[model samples]
Target chain A: MAHSTTLEPTATPATYTDAPRTGTWDGGNEPFKASYGKLMMWFFLLSDAFTFGAFLTAYGMIRHKHGVFTGTAKQFYFSTAHWPIPEKVFNAFPGLHGDLPLAFVALMTMILIFSSVTMVLAVEAGHRMDKADVQKWLLWTILFGSMFLSSQAWEWSHFIGGHEEGTRMADGTLMFGANLAMNQYGPPLFGDLFFFITGFHGTHVFSGVCLLVWCFIATTNGTFEKRGHYEMVEKIGLYWHFVDLVWVFVFTFFYLV
Target chain B: MSAHAAEAEHAYVPGEIAKPNTAWIWKTFWVLVAITALEFVIAFTLTSPDWRTFRNSIFIVLTILKAFFIVGEFMHLKHEVKSLIWTVLVPTSLLIWLVVALVTEGSFIGEVLSHMFT
Candidate 1:
């Protein structure tokens, strides 16, 4: 509701005390010494961490429920009775044949990390008010991020396409690739969790890329220059780093563990 | 505008941005890469079933180590005020409890499923 009293402009815009607060809890100052936007970004990231944590924890539970596979890698086969080894499922690589194990995913991880580095570089450039450097680093970050997404797309396709032979289900029908309902992998839940968790992370990456583009545009437009601060770059840098951090965990739990 | 409103709008002046540390950023990147490489090596080498627990634990520890660098250096959390650091980290520690409780319950259900279906 609009308040007429508050909305009306006063003759003198009353100035507040510029004196330093005596205590951290004194209501007038930023106790954390961070801008409101930065603090909120941290909080948002914290909340997002919990969301991913819940997903991974649920993944761990479902994985534990399915039980670990005891057979050697070579001896392992697609079956609903036992959980499939991650390496076995994710072995395919682009333009290569045979089992490459965790190679492709590792490449994806590196791409994301590199992008994160570029993002931080961009943020650093922003702090110096170097518009050229900011645009340069942001471009690199966006490039690397797009590379990661493309790699993920390839991985997902390879996963969904399955091998030509395919695995025979209990009912004698041959199943190819993976979907929410059934997969040639092990249990249906395996395919389901893989898609959901990684898909969620992928969505975050996609959005992060879009944000980087926006930051790049703003940098070119001299928006932050006019504002006398590049805090916007820092905020988006936080988000980009958060995405990379989530991938580190995902790499471990989803693939390695 | 009223004094309260004026104060509200102008009270929060942001502090100066910290100086950039390019060297630290590169060092952190190398550290992350090294840790990830180690993970891959372990995954490829430790294939036996008996080593599963040990391997998983190592992976978890290494992942946490990587997380420290990413959050601390890349996200610049380590440079923030102490209160901000605690606020971000304290709430995250609850995930440990969540993991323990849910995972324990999961194992029990898993045992039931294995018995029922097999």
Candidate 2:
């Protein structure tokens, strides 16, 4: 009767006869203090991280099995005998010709990072319930996400099209472009990993863009305004940031390292 | 249900909602940009075969550093409850074992392949 008298409605209802309710884990309060949707987003991101980690790990193993080309940067050239240097392979920039290694990918990295900044700003505006600011920042985030996707498209086309002089295959015929079958870049595995990893990452960016568009529309429609909370923007913002986080690793392992 | 009780049912407790901090956001943006630029500089200058291992180590270290900021600040994971932070981070730490095992095994395979191919 003493415990029953002290029982608060906010606490989980007493079920056991003897056990005292600790209140934290009594099933009434959220232990993490996060809404279900937000916590689910974090878990989803965690699983997505493993998916990427597995791909990159496999790539590293295969790359190690095929020794890298250790010659000087000037001496480096595409060959089937060894792993090609990433800089030499990814050297092209749209509109600009010649060997400016990593410049274009660097530009893409900047674009992704900038978009992430905009996404957080949108979330911040949402916190204040500033619908207009949320829409504006969300628009910038979408624009940057699209720019990043376009940059990737150009990079992929360049990769698939190959260079002026293609690598000579084992059959003594010159092979231009890259496919799952072969590549001008080095081992066939090189092209395969490049396509799979970056393509998977690109798909994520595309989806993030689509989600942002939906969030933008919802803001325009004053849906969050009616709900009196902008948690939807926060949820999408988590996904957008996770995409950017994946890009950081992709940029490192695929390009820099 | 009475209005007061209904409101109480859904209310966020103190510190549940973070304050809007624009300045901190910009500061994090600059930090991310600076780290990325540094990575580019190292990539270009440290191109010699001799520095390959050392340079790669630096890149990985910097990458993890950047990851901290992106996940902690941008994702707002740092501001979340302690249990939530650990739930996300503790499981991710398992990736270290996967990277080590596979890469070491890959080198051994590389040794075997070299003999066969040659």
Candidate 3:
């Protein structure tokens, strides 16, 4: 059947069995030529962005109301303030613990960003149809992603376990360690939001790593080679970069601010 | 002959698959590293509470800058069709506006609570 150039539908006789292609939205050809998988991925990421934004916005509201701990070492030991400073709350390293504020988190951020670079390289290699290069870069990306996950696990353990003892309240109760109900750090909400936001981001990183593994396996086995397209690598690269983008905002609002 | 038949008869040559140059990737990586280092320097060096608001603004700006690079270059969103780009960016922007409104109302509620309790 002949296809019409315009998108409008045409009038036809009732007896006609085969209708002409109208180039309308009913057809499978997308104006963007975006694959169904990639377009759906974009929509999914958009909704996920709203979820994270709502969480962070709620965090901002609570933080603004309660205020943060502004006491120093001198006041911290003597004063009875409940809120704790963020840097003080997250100052411990894995081995060394001499007030290395923001050091560990900064390292984790670098590792995640570097993994993003490797993902970009993988997509570029896929563009060139270099299967070996794509495999190598994907491996590197997975390694860095796993390293970042491990770093987060260590940080969570250190926080939940507590290093040195925190301040004792006047009620003869020791205020140490963090949980959903209570936290040694500033407010209880502070710990709750930290776990929620960072945990969610970590889960994304884990998922991205899994996707990379699949892509790597597919590349090595010549699946994309047979299809003669490397767009899968590009699609996964978009998700990986989006993960890194969200972390940028999380680090800014949660840690730096 | 029909157009489809003519097109099918042509050689199945692949698109340009020349050796990829990776200089641009490293350039973006170094840019991100430099911005992060600057953030750390600002974080540790500026200890005075007097500069708290100023420092916080710096952090936000730097964070957005990093996001631009990651989304634009790494994800190749900048190279996509304008309509496709808008499809992803415009809706997400409404979420940002929601954040501003919610936080403002939240702080106002805090003020009301404090007035009643104090």
Candidate 4:
């Protein structure tokens, strides 16, 4: 919702890049944080940027170690024993469970994406000082965010609640997934790594939902309005967008590419 | 290159915010969504080797486009000062390179072990 207007400088930090705005900040403060709000946004984005970079790098490391873990049509997975395709393992449907192709996860992805959009709109509304617009969009943002968290919880339960396929070992513990002896899906590391990466992501999404809820309640309580600015929208917008940006990377590496 | 660079430099006079058209932004969103749908479709439907390659290419391109839109529009990177532009994209680019390099190394290790063990 950034207005395409003549860039005006209004007491922003001198470091505020892009063309200098025509407006100037008269409220004498440290130059860098012309608006403490925008500076805070930058700070949040930087920290979140590091978190995503770490996760994606770790994903790349693990995924690279595995050599062609997927096999189509039930053929042997690879030269070694094969692993079940991700498509197969992740294929779960709610009521229509007999046969489906990852519908639930797909729905979750959509909700997250939609939430990202709504959050942006909320921020835009903030820029315009339109409290009503902010409220409407932020409410949608909260709803979608909460739905995503619930969907993730369902997904995790389905994953962890399911039984391990292998029979009991000498000690009577069922050996499931890939391991040195059992070569189900190429290697045991696949399940460990898969759960770790997606689990980490899901945890972040959960935290993001909490933050969004806080923002929603604050908005409802007229917090931003009282502050006389919607910088909170912008700050929360940065976090929301980071969640989405990470998801795009996750979708590419984990699901598609 | 000079002409483009000079044009970019010349157009970037400070003060007035550059007002990109709203309609075009809407159009971009529609195009972005269409491409995303197409990406998922191609992902589900195509399995041929060449098709997979093409699909992968398209998927990456579309993802980049989607990211560009989010940054350029929603994050308002386009409106940010040039230094801000550098601050954001430079880190992102470095991270991408780092991922590529790390993956390449891991894949290479697999290739070596693949040959030796087999």
Candidate 5:
């Protein structure tokens, strides 16, 4: 090969701006200072929030229409009106025969909140580079998350199974437990909304647990240690906390209000 | 990796706890519990139809407060940069508006339709 003594660069000069080495679209050096992973997670949560908001809003709209009417379609405007009391509907609790309004869900709420605390602790330990503490707290978190899911399952079964004896309608037709098309609960929309909203939230919890378990296994295998950061834990913590946060709203919209 | 390089790369002091005291976490937990308990009490004791609207408003307010705690503290959004906080919080506020608009408009439509049909 013959070597040329004079060097000539023929390529056009690449244009440059103040943009980051990584494309601005990729969120490099953004003011938020959050990693791409974290930023994307936030975006996802934001969209998910809208999904939930839309569902709840639709429920509220339908409920407002049907919830207040008591009489048949002919004299609907002249009928006495009341929404089905949520506390009354969800009164049953495990290991108790009598009515205990909101107690079961209350316990479920506490369990979820406690799990959030564990998640925070796990993130804290991650920051401290304490592998064992992260493992332990993550384990507790997984336990609590599992407990929440199981309780939700039990609640769903109980709700679907219908504990309330058939309520007699004006035409003397009997209504049983909740179904998409019908429900003993005041309005058909109520059961439908309950199943849809809670089921959606339950799916999030389920996925959150799966993510937690993934983190737990990776932590046990020292993946984070090698990476020299526990950002994974923090990222997962955001998701877990988000799930808990959504439940707070659900608890209020469905159970309390 | 060399010890010095490893230390520099990690940038965390091993065995040193981050936010060592967990009192804040516990405090938030108690606040959540208290709010939930109060919600229960109100649900059971406030039976009058006149209070239904007011009770619902209270439930919403309390729920928002609890949500603030969970997102602000547990998720550590409160401690994040001002821009990041706003980035999240501003959009979320729009959701509340979305709910309000949809509910109010939907209810009004329902009321008009029901009355018109009747």
Candidate 6:
């Protein structure tokens, strides 16, 4: 429709009807209609982008309305008025913990960042048609992705475990939502939003790990190598990079903002 | 019938780097990293009631810049013809606009809530 209904053929596209439906987005054409995989991947990314945008926007709206102080956020467990700050809450250590700063989450962030790097490396390996390199980088990317997922698991546990000073409702009454408001560390909305946004993202990461693992497994068994190129790597790379990109926004909005 | 079905109409080369310029990749990476760092620094250093507005404006600009490089270089949005570029950017821009409108409505509710309940 785009070409037929339109007058000019701006870019030349090559058709490979014989190729397997291996991707929704990946390398198909150097400049024309990308492979079905890459196209689909972009569609997925676009939908995902909207989902994330919606969440962050809602979070912002809530923050603007309820960001003010109802009372001195008091720490119930620690016996202090300093309730759990977002940075402080996420920063603490697990075992040898002593008022650390963004320890676990920071580690998780690094893991994700490394995974992003590994993903690019894998894509590069794909470009070279180096199966060994593709396998190596992709495996590293998968492992790091798994590690990030685990770290997120730990973060969730800590959040659900409940903090000292919890959430204060609109009535100025402090109530526990089963560690609902005053979680194991700080405010309830912190956990509420943390779980809602990051949890959803964590699900995506988990799924991505599964996808990466599948791709890596295929790499070992000589799938992409058999096909004679690394478009697979780039296809998944796009998704991986998109995930990393989304996290940057989530971190900025939920943490720093 | 689908645009994709006209695949025979367009020639394709798989995994071929459009620019074939490694130099641009490295240069773009450095520029992107530098801009990201600057964004972080400005986010931390600024302090004003207009801080929210200023920070938001800067963050958005930085985000758009970063997105451009990623799309242009990494995702190869630039390699495609101008029509393709316009097709993608127009839709994505419209999506962002939709989100912005929804969020503004949410903020309005927040304002009303603050007045009634606060």
Using all chains and alpha carbons, the TM-scores for the candidates as numbered come to 0.89, 0.89, 0.86, 0.74, 0.85, 0.71
TM-score of chain B of each: 0.79, 0.80, 0.78, 0.67, 0.80, 0.73
Candidate 4, superposed: residue stretches over 4 Å from native:
A1-34, A69-84, A162-186, B1-29, B49-51, B115-118
Report the CA-based lDDT of candidate 4 relative to the real structure.
0.65
Q: Which lDDT tens digits does candidate 4 get at residues A1-257? A: 98878977678676776564555574544544235676677767777677777777866675676666443434532222233445555667655655355567677777877787777767755655566777888889889988887777777666555423543444555554343344333355555666766777777777777877788788878897777666777777877777776777677766676
The DockQ assigned to candidate 6 is: 0.16
* Overall lDDT per candidate, in order of appearance: 0.87, 0.90, 0.80, 0.65, 0.81, 0.65
lDDT of 1 by residue, A170-250 (tens): 999999999899999889999999899999999999999999999899999999988977899999999999999999999
A35 in model 6: Cα distance from truth in Å? 1.7
Q: Per-candidate interface C-alpha RMSD? A: 4.0, 3.2, 3.2, 5.6, 4.2, 5.4
Give residue B49's error in model 4 in angstroms: 4.3
Candidate 6 chain A weakest lDDT stretch, 10 residues: A72-81
Q: Rank the candidates by TM-score, best first.
A: 1, 2, 3, 5, 4, 6
Report the error of model 1 at residue A127, Å.
1.0
- Model 4: residue B68 alpha-carbon error in angstroms: 1.2
**Top lDDT prediction, candidate number:** 2
Superposition error at A189 for model 2 (Å):
0.5
Q: Model 6, range A105-160, lDDT digits (tens) per residue?
A: 55665677668767776776566566777888888988999888877877777666
True contacts kept of 5: 0.62
- List ranges where model 6 is wrong by over 4 Å: A1-31, A69-85, A95-104, A163-190, B1-44, B47-50
Which candidate number would show the highest DockQ if scored against the true structure? Answer: 2
Tell me the DockQ of each model, to 2 decimals: 0.44, 0.46, 0.41, 0.23, 0.42, 0.16
lDDT of 6 by residue, B3-116 (tens): 222322333355443322234445666766677667657744763434656777777777677767666665666665676678667766776676577667766876786588
TM-score of the first chain alone, every candidate: 0.91, 0.90, 0.86, 0.72, 0.84, 0.75
Question: What's the C-alpha lDDT at position A244 in model 5?
Answer: 93
lDDT (10s digit) by residue, model 3, range A152-219: 99989988876477756557788777788766776677779889999999999999989999999999
Of all native A–B interface contacts, model 2 reproduces a fraction of 0.82
How many steric overlaps does candidate 4 have? 20
- What is candidate 5's lDDT per residue for A39-75, written digit by digit as tens? 8888888889888888888877776765463333233
Q: Report lDDT (Cα) of residue B37, candidate 1.
A: 91
Docking class of 5: acceptable
Quote the true-contact fraction of every model.
0.85, 0.82, 0.64, 0.29, 0.62, 0.19
Q: Which tens-of-lDDT digit does each residue in B3-114 have in candidate 2?
A: 2212213544433544455877888999999999999999989889999999999999999999999998888887777899999989999999999999999999999978
